[model samples]
Every structure is written in C-alpha cells, then in structure tokens.
Target: MARFRSICNTLEVLFFLIFSAWSLGNRGSEAKDTLLAGEKLRDGENLVSAHKLFEVKFINLENSQNRYLAILYLFGYDGRAVWIANRDNPLMDSSGVLSINRKGNLVLTSGKGNSTIINSEEPAMGGNTSATILDSGNLILRDGERILWQSSDYLSDYTLYLQNDTTLGTETTREKGRQLLDFGHSAKRKLWLQITVLVLIIMSAFLIAFIICRLKSRYCDSGGNNEKNEENDTASSRLQLNKFSDIEAAYKNNNASEQKLCGNKDSELPLFSFSSIESATNNFSTTNKLGEGGFGPVYKGKLVGGQEIAVKRLSKMSRQGLEQFKNEFTLICKLQHRNLVRLLGCCIEGDELILIYEYMPNKGLDSFLFDPMKRALLDWRTRVSIIEGIAQGLLYLHKYSRLKIIHRDLKTSNVLLDCDMNPKISDFGTARVFGQNESQANTSRIIGTFGYMSPEYAMDGLFSEKSDVFSFGVMMLEIVSGRKNNGFYQTDSDLNLLGYAWDLRNQEKILELMDSTLVDSCSTNEFEFIRYVHVGFLCVQQSAADRPTMSEVVSMLSNETTSLPSPKQPAFTIGKSNIGVESSLSTGQESVNDVTISVMNGR
Candidate 1:
C-alpha cells in the first residue's frame, strides 16, 4: 500500500508540472501586465495588456555613466521616459530578480542577501501590497488597496514631473503634491546577486532539458526548432527598427515607450500640478479663452485670490510647441523691461505647455489699430506716443538688454497695450538672441507674418536689428494712416497701404496720408504729425543700411526739433509685384482690394 501511494504522488507532481508549463505556453501574451516582473519579463518584450501607457525595461540614462530600472511613458509624447524605480541601486545584469517578497514588501534581492526593500508600514502578510498600473505611466504600491507609494508621486528624473493642480508663478509644494525620489546610497549589491541567480536558473533549466532530450531525441528536435523560430522573430523585430525614420515611431509600434531611460534630475524649472491649472481655468472653459495663436489657445484665468492672468496653452497639434516652451521659458525668465511683457510663470505638466502673462485690459495693439471704428479713438498724439513707445522697446532689444535680441517677427499684433494704452512689446515666440557682435542669421525654415517682414528676411532668410526696424516702419505707416499695410486702398490707385503712403509722400501730398479720424479728433499741428510719417518712411527704406537703428529711430522720433532725412521708395509697389491678400477699403462691400494683402519675395 505504501509503494502504491508513492507512485500515485509522483504521478500527481508530474501532471501538475506539465499543466503549469502548458498554461504558460498556450495562454497567449494578451494577458501580460507591464508592471509584473518574473517569468513574463523578457528582453525587448512589451507587455501591452497590463498598462497600455507604460513599458517594463532597462535603459541607459541620457548622458550618464549607469543604467537604471525604469518604466517608460507611452502616451501623447515624442517618446519621453518617466518614473524610475530602483533608480540609484540598479541591477548590474539582466538576471536581477524583482518581486513581492513573502512579507508583502516590494523586494529586490540578488545572491548573498543583497537586497532592497520598498516597504509599506502596514503591509498585510503576503497579499498586503498590490501593484496597480496607472494611465499616467505610474506603478503604485497599495497596502490592502490603500496606496503606500507610487512612482509618479516621486520624481527623480527631470522628465518625470508630476501632474497636479497648482497655480503658476507660486512656489510649489513638495509633499503636498509630489516629491522627487533621490538616487542615494541603498541596497545595490543584493540586486547584482539576484542577476547572477537568474542566470543560474536559466542555465539549470537548459541543463535539465538537455538531459531529457538525450532520453527523447525526436521530442528535443522539435523543441530546438521552436527556439530557432523565436530567434527569427527577434531578428525580424530588430529589422523593423531600422525601417523607421525616428525613434518615436519605432517605440510606439513595439509599445516600448514606457521604458524609463534615466534617473538623473537635470531640469531646473519647478513642476506645476495639472489640477491647479485645470481648476484655475475652470476646466478649460470656452468663456475663459481670449484667442488662439500658432501654438494653441489663450485663456484668461483668475487664480485663488482673483489675480488675473493670460495663459497661452500650446495645442497638441503644435509641432513646435515643446521647442517654443523651452525657448520662451529660458529667454523670458532672464529678460526684464517696462516695454516688454512680463512673464509670470510657465506650466509644463503632461502635454500642456502654458505661459502665464500679466493681463492687458486693452488687449493687443492690432485689435485697435486695424479696426476702422477703433482707429478713430486714437488721435494723432496717441498714435505718435505709441510709435515712440515701440521704438524704445526695440532699442532695448537691440542694445540695452544683457543679451542682444532680434525681434524677427515684430508686428502690431504682437504689441500689447496696457490699461493706460501704453504699448508693450509681447510674444517672444519667434524672437532669437545673438551673441555679442553676431549681426545676422539664416534658417531654411522661414517663420513670421507676411507684409511686416523686410525684403531681406522674407526672401533670403537674413535677419538683424534692421529687420525689426523695417517691421516697425510698416507699423509706423499703419498707425499714421490708420490702415493695414497689406490691405490699404484708394479709389484712384491700386497701391497697398504702404504703397499708397509712399506714392502720396513721393508726390508731396503728405496731408492726404493722415488718418481722417486723427484730423477730426486732434488739435495737434498737422506739420509735426506729418514729420512722424517722414520718420516712418526713413525707417522703412528697402536697404537695411538706409533704415535707422532703434537708437537713431528713437532719437529721430523723440526730438521734434531734428529735421529727418529724405525717405526712399519702400519695397513691393503695386506695379512691381502683387503681394499678400488684397482687401477693399469699402464698408459692407467686398472688392478686389479687400482681398487679404499678401507680400511675396521682393526684388
């Protein structure tokens, strides 16, 4: 009876082993969870089912000497890595063991007692801690479903900023929202030991299989063929990576973007929580939005204490949004001038890149100067003051500031007006700074609005302080005539606003160039105002050398006693070229001239 019982026990054990192996082999990979580490963990394998937004893997830190245990983010991004676990004490080899220990501790142990314990104070025996994967690419640890720790809440890498609801410009709290996990002295040797153990396990399994194969040669041949097939699949995957143009696409297809690359903190900017910005914007209410730009929409938000701010949120479709955010933040933080718009702060939580600015009651200058009815409100004196203010601002950009900045795309729309109607140069999105004595730069990908761009910048991509002066010149003419540079018309001539102004100036019919609205409201001397037009013409000269520097322009505008030099012909006359969208001057009726004035590359 004892011999029979022993035989039955041996049969039962063999059957159980066979069943487990069969279940593992035939269960299909669809049930795999990303965060789980064990037999499911394979080299270059993406677990899609566990967490669609993250991946499990090892990666080299960006420009670092060591690698780390991390989870890579796979969401609305250009394949950014976030949330590192065991950042400081990473396993040296692929064989390192990561698993929940018997005591409910998230333990990482190598050979010879080398170990790391991510402890939960109230850990419930073996089932105390449960690992959950979040949409934010975070793996959380819970004690009986209560979160004890989370990867997202602790940011050790600069790329992994936690999303929370915090106001822009205010100092953020560390514990209140999230804290950066530091890479300090911890259990690293034990992790290395576990890697060795893993290798031994794999070797032992292969050795056992080899002995079995000797006994059953035919069955072993089939297993050897299956291994060859796995190798072929792996080779095919490597070939796919070479076929893709960029790293982003390759990672997405394989669902490998969630792998964390680094554990270093290199970013200097403070993290703003998503909840704060969301609550402030009233959940991105349409009513709070002021307008839209190349980046995204602008929202008018009021903080906790009723502090009003204008927030520029970069849209997901904005291809250059990240570059713009980094550029604007780095540039705006160092710059300070009364004529320039003040950057309150920026929010870069998740895909959102938000810029907060002081609210301007009068909004942008373009809104007033371009609108016919609104233009009438600005008399000759107000217009002249605005032009002078703009000149001062430009002068600061060209010479007075710590860094030499070129306002590559200066236009009336970018100029904001305060409550007192003072012009403040805004929107440094397209602005570029040059080293001392560096005069001009060129880019194949040209950017900036039409009509305001200088001939040199518009055609050949050459830009300098003179380019800004040329834009200022165009704006000057618009202010003086109360018309848009691209959409000006007279019954007699087909010339654009600038062309007509040039024609009138050429014929010495300077009085005709004055805005009729200014004529009715202002008691200021007409001759003095026409002198402002003369200065405008000088600044708008086709040649950069002929156009005055901001300092010279400021001097010319400020000194009423100084007689200005004769102005040259501006670029792009009606007979020379058909430029931007042509628009009609008539109200309630659209004509050929009403077409939006477009400017082409000049002679």
Candidate 2:
C-alpha cells in the first residue's frame, strides 16, 4: 500500500509540472495591445490590436533572410505588411527586441548591441508614455490624451484603413452589437449546440447527394453517357478554337495598324493588357497626363496595389513610326545600367502602342537646370554628379554594354531625375548598335536634335561614338553656363554658346560662364568646375579624332591626377552667320528650337 501511494504521488507531481509549463507557454504566446515603459517585446511576441484587425511584430519577409519590425493586417491569411519600422536597416537575426527605453522613446534593439530609436524627436515623458497598437492599424505613443507619435503620419508602404461606415450605425455594426450582447454562458452553449447541429445536417446532406451521384454514374447506360461525353469534348474544342481565332485577330489588327509583336522573341518582356493600363491611368485623364514628347504623350499612373508607373503612349500624329518604337523597346529592355531609365513593360493592342517605365518623380534635368526659380536647387555638387552620371552612362553604351550603342540623340531633356536627384539616361529611339570591330557608320538619314549634332554627322553623314561625345559636351556647357546653346549668342559677336565658351577659356574668364545661381557653391569647388569646362571643350573639338573617347573622359573626370591635353577650336564656332549658311547649304535643314529632326540628307 505504501509503494502504490508513493507511485501515485510521483505521477501527480509530474502532471502538475507539465500543466504549469503549458500554461506559462500559452500566456507567453498571447499578444498584448499595449507596450509600457521598461517592458520588452521579444522576437516571438506580438502586439495585437483590441479588435484583432492588425498585429505588430518582427517578421521575415518572403524569400528574404533579413527580419523587420512591421505592422500587418491580421484578417487576411497573407498578412500583408502595411508599414515597416526598419525597412532600410533590417536585423540579420531573429534576436530583436522592441521596447520603450528609460527615455520614453520606442527603440528597436538587436542582439548585436545596435539600437534604433524610432521616435527620436519626441520629448521624454518618463514612465507615463505608453505605446498602443490601434484597431485602425496605427501604432501610437501617447501619455493620456496627448499623442507624441503615430504611424499613420508616416506612410512607407500601401494604404490600408477600416471604413468609418462600419462604426456609424451600419448593418455590420448592428450585427456585431447583437453578437456581443448574446454572450451569456447558457446562451453561448445553446448557440454552439445549434451551430453543431446545423453543420452536421449540411454535411450529411452533401454526403447523401455525393453517394447518389456516384451510384448513378456507375450504373448509368453506357451509350447515353458516351454521347454526352462526346458533346462536351466538342464544346471544349470549339471554345479553344474561338480563343485562338481571337488571338489571331488581335495579331492581324496589330500588324495592320502598327508594329507587330516580335513573335515570342521578346517573350521575357511583359505585355500589359489595355484595360489594366486604362484603369491605372484613369482613362488617361488630362490630370494624369505628365507631358508630351517626341514619342507621344506620357502620363503618371498608379497600379491597383498603389505602385506608381509612367506610361508612354505613342500618339497617332507622332513622327516616330514602327522602327523607332521597336528600336526603343528592344534596346532598352536588354540594356541594364544604374544611370539608365528602367523599362517595365509594353502594350500593343489594336492601334494602341504604349511603353511603361519606372516613374521619375523629379522629371527631366532641363526642368531644374533651365527654370530660373529651380536653377538654384542644382548646386555645384549636384551638377557635378549629373555630369559624372551622364558620362558613366555614355561609357556604358559605348564600351561596357553587351552591344556597342551610339546614342544619336543625347540632350538634357532626355536625362531623367529620380527622387534622390540621380540622373538616368532615357530615350533610345534613335540609338544604333555597332559590330564588335565597327567604330563608325554612315547614314543619310540624320535623326537628332539640331544644336547637338556633330559636324561630321551633320555635313557628311558620318556618325560614330565621337558624335555622342560632341552632344554631351554641348550639354555640359549648357549645364555650367545656364544658357541654351542655340538661343544664346555673344552680345558684340554673333558667336553662339560654343564660340563664347572658347573665348572665355582663352581669356581665362571661365568663371564668367558659370551660372549666377551656382555662385555660392562654385566658390569652394572652382577648380573642379574649370576642369569640367576643359573636358567639355576637349569633347567638342573641330576634328572628331581630336575628341577624347568616352572612357578617357570618364577617367579624366574621376581621377584628378590625370593630365588633360589642350583643346582645339570646336566646330560651328566660326560665327553663327557663316556656320548657319554652310549647314543650310550642306544638309538643307535649318535649326529650329532644338527639335529632333527625323529626316535630313547629307551633302
């Protein structure tokens, strides 16, 4: 009897210990709605809203190893993240903790001893401040009614919020109120019982129907079933044929109206449906239209998921035809560089031909460089960065890219700026690729902006990498001087910008050419500014052979120690009158507001 009692006691002790551990674990897993000062929320723990609509915790994104603290929707299985605390600085491990430090600021501390204060600007409220996750997916820090910080004010990702209609005496609110009121113990038991009975009845009816169908199918007459099967197959075949014919009709329409699809050769590039594009751009409303270019009208659009995009639609009246559209799509899709604009996809349906690209918030370089009010924004450092970025992009096209491409039309308007003011080269409609050993090509059809065209290309139809260098040099001069090349002429002399810059260099008054707005920044970086002008002069030399290669230009701009050779007089600097007469007689085309010329014959 004593041995049996001891055995029972041991078993009871074991059961008690197991139950205590299980209870502790369950409590730990339960999410809290508030985080007070001096309390830490570890990696595996979460702060859930009172209504269970949203959750805040550390999460590892799909296919990414880094962990981030994010607020996510809890109603959906996907748990889409609405906001992230540390998006750019993610924790490499799971050992991350969220807490309000002694200073009453929300801080994220990693196991590696690095800490990030989320609300650094908020004044310390001692132990009175508390962080709470609201049902509206907003995380707020408050002391009583006074709010210190809130997540809704800072939008990092997609927009998400509960509709106010639900709380304003709607059917949903009434139903929720009814559910909460009928929560007595006996009422709940009766409700569960009724639900169980209803579910059983539904399942039993489905099982009976399933059994009957199976029996009928197994015992049915063979001839009738065979006829039915044949009819179904015929209907399926007709459906497939109809789909194929519809595709064929679309192909024919595309070929008749505009450029045809390259037939799976460019299958890797996505083809956006016409309806989606229309919806994204709000039917291409005038408000959404960004600007018009040589290709056509461009519009700003937002996808269904709140992703912004720029749509380049080819206008029916545009001079750029099938060749230019196809050229831009094919070349830009293959070329990848940091300084180049990204092509997302294209659209070709009926007479509609559109190209989708990553939206640039700051638009083109000319918008800031030419606008008097905005010119001050481009400080000396920013101008230098843009110059270097343009040079790097040209070097990539000329030597580093898979194809040796010569951008026939390089101008300020073709350079886009991102939100960070980084320059990206765009518009590949007039670019041409060359063979590995080929250095230059001749074309009677000269297509490029007027003032940017090189002397050889304009006079003799000979174009090479040197021609693009010449265009870049012109742009460089314009960026520094804040004057349009074709419009600006010396007061006393009829010399254009190029000739004026040459005279300034000779007289050692190069600073006179600097933009008035850049005076403050130019004071400290005067030498760097003069070096850029010297390099620009070297690029626009009269002889193509005298111009430095794009690679050499990059080296000179990057390495200050590199020696630069003296530049000869650039072409088209022999007074505007003589050069204009010669150019008109040779190409038979007069310069117009620096517009792109599609067709010009060489002499």
Candidate 3:
C-alpha cells in the first residue's frame, strides 16, 4: 500500500506539470512575432502568438473588425480561432477583452454586457454551435453533430498562411436535381408495347425532361453553369457577348487583321479574379511596390498557393490611353522569343487593368550597375555574359520572332535579370512590329528615351531596325564603362558616352574606359573584351544605313577570322535641338511615378 501511494503521487505530479505547460501555451505568451513595417494596428499592442506555435491573436481582419479573441491551434501550425464569445456583437472601440472564463471556456463580452457565444460544448437553450479548426486548414462550427459553417466550404479572398500540406482540391460541379436512370429493353417476337402503361409513362417523362433540359441549355450562358441572374447580370452578359462579336467582326472587316496585332483569338489565356489579386497583395500595401513607369506602377504579389508574381497596374491619368495599352498587350502576347520577356497573362477587371508577369528576383540591370557596392557583384565574366545575353535576346526579337519587332525603348532600366544572371529584354510598351518586306516607317509623334534614341528618330521620327541598334550600342558602351550615356561628362564637354568612346577608340586608350569591377576578373581576357568594345563602337554609327544589322553584329562577335571595319565618328551635336523637346522626353518621361504595394507576412 505504501509503494502504490508513492507511485500514484509521482504520476499525479507529472500530469499537473503537463497541464500547467499546456495552460501557459493556451494564453499565447511564447510565440515570436515579426512586427513588419506598415502593420500599424494599435499604439503598443499588436498580434501575440503562443510559444507552442498554435495561436495568433489580433483578430481584426476584413470581416473580424474591432474584435479580439484567444484561439487554439488544433493542428501543429493552424489557428483554430474557435473562441470568439462576441460573434454577432462586436466592440465599437478597443474596449473589448477576452480571457479564460472560470469554466476554462474562452469567453468574450461587449461593453454593453452583450455576450455572443463563439464555441460551446453544449448548445445554448434555444441555439446550437461548436467551433474548431481542423488539421486540414478547415475552421468548422457545428450545430449538434452536423456542421453549420466551415472554412473549407466557404472560400474568401484572404486565407491564413499556416504551415501545412493542406491543398485546395480540384473543384467539382454542382447540379440541381439530376439523377441517373436505368434503361430496360424487352425482346419479344410479337410487337411488345409494355402491358403496364405506368412504365411507358415513365419512359415518355424522361424524354420530355431531356428535351426541356436541352432547351434550357441553348438559352443559358455558354460559360458553363456559372451564370446567375441578377439585376446587372443580363447587361454584363450582353457586354461580354458583344465583345466577342466585335472581335469576330474586326477580323471580317479588316482583311489584314490576321496579320495585325492581337489577332490570335485561339490562344489559351489565363483568367484570374480581381478579388484574388487584391487579397494576394493585401489590398496593394505600400511595402510591395517595386517600381513605377509611364504606363503604370509595378507591384510584387504572391498567390495563395505561394507563387510570386509581379503586377503592373496602369494609371488612368497617364498620357498613354486605352488604345496604347491594347497595342502593348497585343504585341506582347504574340511576340515570344528567348530574348524577349515572356508575357504570362493579363487581367482586365473594370477600370483595373493589370498585367501579370513572372517575377524577376534581381530586378532591373540599373539597380546593380548603378549601385556602388552592388556593382562589385557584376564581375568581368558576369558583365560579359550579360552583354552576350542581351545581344542574343535582341537578335531573337529582331530576326527570329514571327514578326520583326523594333523595341523603341531599350534602356538599362528595361533589361531584367533572371535567377541565373541571364538578361531578358522587357517592356514592350513602345515596341512596333514590321513586316519582312516593309523597310522604314515614320511617326509624327516621336516617343523614345532621350539619350538612347537615335538622332534620326529624335529629330524627324524616322525609325526602323536601326533605332534599336543605336540604343543597344549606347547600352553596350554604358555596360563597358560604368557611366550613364546621357548623364556622364556634364562639365567642360558636351560629349556623351558615345563621344567619349569615339575619342578613346581613336586614341587607342579604350581599355581605360572599362569598368574597374572587370579589372581583376578580366585580367586574362582583356584582349577579347577590347575587341567587343571596338565592335560596339562600329554599330553606333551616325547613319541608319551605316549601322550593322543585328545578324551581322552577331556574326562579328562570334567569328574570330572576320576582320571588323573601322567605325566613323558618331554624331554628338544633339544639345542644339529644341530644349523643350529635350526636357519633356528626357527628364519628364524617364522619371516614372511611385506606387504603394502590399506584402503579406509568412507568404
């Protein structure tokens, strides 16, 4: 008896310690918090987590406004949010408080003494409810044994980013009152009309039912059974049909439309909801804003399934109108080359037109090439590779793609970097497509970056394949020498990067113009790099006819046997042009506006 009493006492103490630890964890005192910038809720108080990694509090969300509660994580990392004593009634101010009641049932009461039951083991005298977060990321509330509401069944824009293998399953179609029927056939030598008229009546009924369903389907919306009739539903459906008809009519009206922009009506396109994008971006928080441009502000967003995407939201106030936007959207969808930026998809929701793209982690080339410390990462080998990559991409866009495209705007800021340090030419807002037979085209409105723009295009709006070549040449020089073509040499000389390169090439001191970051890594291959510089100078010639074709440029870069011709002095007297034109196109246009973006924690 004495030995048994000692063993029982030891067991009781162990149970007590376990209960104590669990109680402490339930209070949410131990979990670490990453208080991000822009999550300003209260003055000092914010979300608190349980050390057990089970619960997160600060209960205010899109629907849970001005409410706070203690929740449990039934699974490892999932938050139950089971105990919201104030469900129907919420506090107007921050006066609402939640605490463990005397019975260990978490309770919440309003300042007006109105308490709403969140979860209870037993149903109220007249009502029934029980709430729990399941391991599959499903928050469920039950009335008796049957579920009254569940998070798994009802989907919203935002979802908790809990760490779990919980996956959204494939969606199934819902039908109204449809059942299977078995067919019976009777074989008799004599004409066997069923003696029982009831069975014949049932067969006739099925035929009538099938005919009615077929009739209903003919008039119904063609986008499956997703159609629901509301006040504006009819008008919206008409508009969609009208849009489709217009596309068809456009093809019929313009015989050349097939060759024109945005002609591929058969291409499979991705469709995403506006609400989904808004939720993914946390309603476009200021933190996720990446960069801004003339077209719109670009934002960083993560999808619910953890796919990172960049969204470009076009501003309504911008000089470019809907037509320009359409042209850009159309050109990008059809133009696919290894060197060109890939267009993943686009979203057109009301006035909110957004283009979704594969997120480039390293951002634009300007970010690193211009930064003092970051530039160190771009060694000679990397720089050389980048130059080669850009060249390859341009070659594809110029010669390999279905249509010959002239990228009117090919500046350092538009060159995007992939994960492997590969370069991709992006931003097709100013691109123009030309046929193989068509040589030159002129536009009254001259639109291009000032420093990168060829002299002929800048003055008389004469642009062809050569305009992009000029920009590429200027960019090559900028890459070789860590200096902006337009901004460098502002003091005594009006000479730009082209003029400087011309002078250096003439004096045979071209090696001095190389970026210092390349000096150590390029110790052995300096000669090859010098030859590339000489090639770059040759491409940026004064006349369009004098400039080498992209194909010729590639051949010169690859062939060691091909002797390169000496380049003439480039035209550098652009300061005398209209000062207003220079200021408007150079400073005003290049300086894109800023935008605010949202970043959700634990994405």
Candidate 4:
C-alpha cells in the first residue's frame, strides 16, 4: 500500500508541473499573473488582478494617434488610466510591446523600435527577475523574495490625477478648456486656421532669413586686408558662419539665438569633431537612434577607446534654441555630482550640434517605475534611495551649484538611471539662475511637462525654489503610487491627486493610499514611508508659504522622528462631480480627456 501511494504522489506532482507549463505557454497574454524572463505581453494583451478588481493593458489615447499602457478597472470598457508607462513620450502607433529585456528591466517597445524604459531608476535584477501582477493590483518586479521595482511606488494604491481646469496664463477655465478640445473644432475652420498659420510661418521665415543674411554680411568680414589676414579672416568667417548656421538651424526663428551660443561657448568644455561623433554613432543610422525628444535625437555610441557614450543630436530645424542648449551644457559642465548626469564633451559644426555623455545602461526612470512587470523589482529601500538621490541632485542645483538654479522641468522622464540604479537629474533646457539675493521670479513663457508642473508655475508662471518643491511633492505621490498626475481623473470629483490625498489624510486612511505591495514587502520603517507621504502633502499645500524648503524636506525624510506639521488643502481642486455613472461594465466608451467637473482660479 505504501509503494502504491508513493507512485500516485509522484504522478500527481508531474501532472501538476506539466499542466502549469501548458497553461502558461498557451495562455497567450490573457489572464496572466506572472511573467518570467524572455516572455512578452504584446499590445492588447492584458491581465486582471486576482480578485478581478483592476485591469492592465495597452490603449490608444482618444482622438490622438499615440498609445499608452494603462491600468483600469477589471472587465470594463469604462476607460481610465491609473498608470501610464510612456506619458511624456507616448508611442506613435499601436504596435506596443511589453517585455523583460536581458537586463531584467521591463520595457515597452514599439514595433518600429521606439522603446520606453518603465522601471529604470532602479538597478536591473539581471535575468533572474520575474514580473508579477499582484492581488493588490500592483505590478512588481522581483528576484525571488528580493523586490527590485514595483508600479505601486509610481502611484501606490492611488487613482489617476484629476485634470480639469488647466489654464494658459490668466485665461478663464472656459478659454483654457479650448486647448483640451480634441475634436468639434469645425474641420473647415481648422483648415482655414492651418492655412493662415502656414502663411504667417512662411512670411516670418522669410523675414528672419533676410535679417540673418544681413547680419552675416555685416560680421563675416569685419577687419584685415593682407593675404595672411585675409586667410585668417576667411577661416574665422567660416567658423562664425558655422556657428550661426548651427545655432539658427538648431532653433526655431528666435532672435539673438546664434549670438547666445557664440557667447556661451567659452572654451571650458572640449569640442569634438562631427566626424568622430559620426563614426561613433555609425553615421546616426536609424537603428543607432536610442530616443527622440523636443530637442532632437539621442544615439548610443562607442568611442574608439571603447567608452560607451550617448550623443544628443540637434535636428537642423529643431525647436530648441542655442540659449537652451548653452544653458544645459554650461550648467551641467559647471556642476559635478553623482546625482547629476556627467557631460563628456560636445560638438558644434555647421548645422549640426551634439552633446555627449556617459551611456546609461538603465535609461530613464519612468521606464521601470510605471511598467507593471518591472516595478516590483524596486522594493521599498531602493525606492527611498532614489528619492533621496533626486532630492540631493535638486539641492545641488538649488543651493550648491555655482549659480542657484531652478530645474523648471523636473519629472520622471528627466531623471536618468545608471547601471547600478543611481538617480541622475538631466535636461536643463528650462533651468533658470538666480542671484544670491534673488528669491523668486516670473516668466510669461511657461515651460515644463504637464504632469509635474507646480501649481504656481503652471498657473501664474511664478517660479522660485519653492516651485520645485511643489513638483517634488507631486512626484513623491507618484513614486508612492506609480501613477501620473496628469492622467489621474475622477468622475466624482475635480480633486486631482492632491485633493484625494488630502481626503485620505483627513480620514486618517493615508495608509490606504500607500502602495499596498510595500505594506507587506518592505522590511524598513513603516513610519518612514508614511512620514514621506506627510512631507509630500506638506510640500504640495495650496499656498507656497505653507510648503517646506528642500533642505527641510531632506531633513524630514532622513530623520523619521522629527516633528511634523499638519498639511492644508492642495491647490487647483475645483470640487467633486454630482452626476452618477451606470456601472463599470457599461459598454459605452468615454473620452480620455472628457471633463465633467468644474474649476477654480488661484493655486
């Protein structure tokens, strides 16, 4: 009888293993909870939380060609995005693919090779990592019991941010709402507007070109008559022409841009030849292109000595100007920190301008943090380290740098990751400096990514060091939840992330807002995590006067037992919705940008 039982047990175990393998292999992309290395979750492939509470899948934005990976309610056509893998840089088409690369990072790559790194701010867990969608609706990347990254940190147990009344300057909500209109702007009227805009652009282009030619005629031959002087003059003239052409070509038709680049290139940094860069990047082949941005394309290259580098190349007609380029180059060159991206060298020849840096194997932070499969790999401790690293980098920029600078654009995409998962702040295009006595400043032209913009800066164009604090607060919430503020919307309220957090705080259910995945996985101080949320709330208070400085934030985060202050209401909360929806299973489609709530003025 004992021999018969043993044989039966062995047969059962083998059958179970065989069945599990078959289920996984044939399951395709549906109803999957875990993903091992070398597996893929292609576009339209999705999964639901164990209790059927939430769903994760790829979706195209309403009325827009771009695609995004979204997390929504289980078994529902009622579309809402809790987290997006590629928010700032949405995929151009629907050929989205979610997979674990050899580095063990979760990546969303298009069929055309455009890839978004989802959980990259953390170190890669190698091939041993497995991505799992948890019962708590948290996507975690883990290596056995060791957590490497998780999506919960991006929006930890949170809803998407409510976007209602985003105004351009003092424009009323109705006026500002016009920009959010994806359709209904009469086709004929739009066509007429397009033609009118085209005419204006052409006329403006002619005027600018004519003015540039006059300036070239004036500066190209200013002095000297002898043969040697003439030769020297010609060479100098060529160099000047090259500078002008590169700067002008690099920027849109902006005044005094070429002069800014010429003036800012003070010879402190090495200038590599275009040929060397061309060789390094295989002549900027399409395959060599790593990514694209508002400025231009970035390419991965290897120097002759075998040093891997990333080159930021400016398109001939890029909208980024010489001033922005010079600011980033000069600022980064002058600043040095482990928390900041290193600048190796640069190239400016003719109509081509390129900035080179040490290659980062991990890529951008958003790649990993927002990816469902890879987020669990971050764990809690690694995430805290990243938060501190970002704060330190910001501290360096705000206080320690030679010039007190404000990083106007501080978002997940701008924070890069090294091979070891260290956080480095990059992209200083919109950074502004201040004198020792200067405390605050304002600009008519507001520049920043949508989701991370501070209340004051986004609304009134007023920015100080505190402006960065507000952005940090929003980012802190995102890190805690793994969600994007711009995409978070509620049919019930205009509360956005801040308002919802305020409610949670008021209700003393703040823990409910934390990444439920971390509730059990994190072995570190639970108080510390809660305290970070408190600090975030304090930072994002409605009034800038109520927010703490970065120094205070650092201190608070570092010392858990420090005394804390109660947070006030957050800015831009219009109110909640009174209307009711039928059900989550309702088959009717809703626009992603549909606005049902009201608005307010002051931040």
- Highest lDDT scorer: 2
The weakest ten consecutive residues by lDDT in model 4 span 252-261
**Candidate 3 Cα outliers beyond 4 Å, as residue runs:** 1-267, 573-603
lDDT of 3 by residue, 1-603 (tens): 222222333344334433443353255544333222123223124333323322334465346456654333433224434333344555666655443233323344455564534343544232333344332223444432333444333311122211111442212111110110011112211213432353456446555665665565555656555345422564665554443333323222221222111222112235467898887777888899997777778889999899888888778676463334555566676454455666666666555667788788998998888888888899887887888888888887776554578888788888998888788899887788886567788876666666787767776678898888888888888887778776666355556677777777778888888888888888898887887887777767889898888888888878867898888767553342436435444432334421110111110
Residue 385 Cα positional deviation in candidate 2, in Å, after optimal superposition: 0.5
Candidate 4 TM-score, C-alpha based: 0.53
Candidate 1: segments with Cα more than 4 A from true spot: 1-271, 579-603
True-structure lDDT of candidate 2: 0.74
Residue range with the least summed lDDT across 10 consecutive positions in model 2:
257-266
lDDT of 3 at 117: 47
Candidate 1 steric clashes: 35
TM-score versus the correct structure, for each prediction: 0.53, 0.56, 0.55, 0.53
Clash pairs, candidate 3, are: 30-51, 31-51, 285-597, 285-598, 288-597, 339-393
* Residue 378 local lDDT, model 4: 73
How do the residues 1-603 of candidate 2 rate in per-residue lDDT, one tens digit apiece?
222222333344334433432332244324588998878889989998754657899998767989999888664325767668888789999999998876667889998885755764657543487888865567887653335677754211111111123353356655554554454445646745775575566556556665665565555545475557645665765654443343333333332211111111112356789999999999999999988766778899998889899999987766564456767776776466789898877787656778899999999998999999998999989999999999999998997664689999999988999999999999898899986569889998888876788989877789999999999999999999888776677779988899999998889999999999999988988898999999999999989999999989999999988999999998878555865534554444332333667677876
- Candidate 1: residue 361 Cα off by (Å): 1.5
Model 1 C-alpha RMSD to native: 22.0
- Give one digit per residue, the lDDT tens place, for model 4 in 139-185: 77765434567765322211111122233123454344454333334
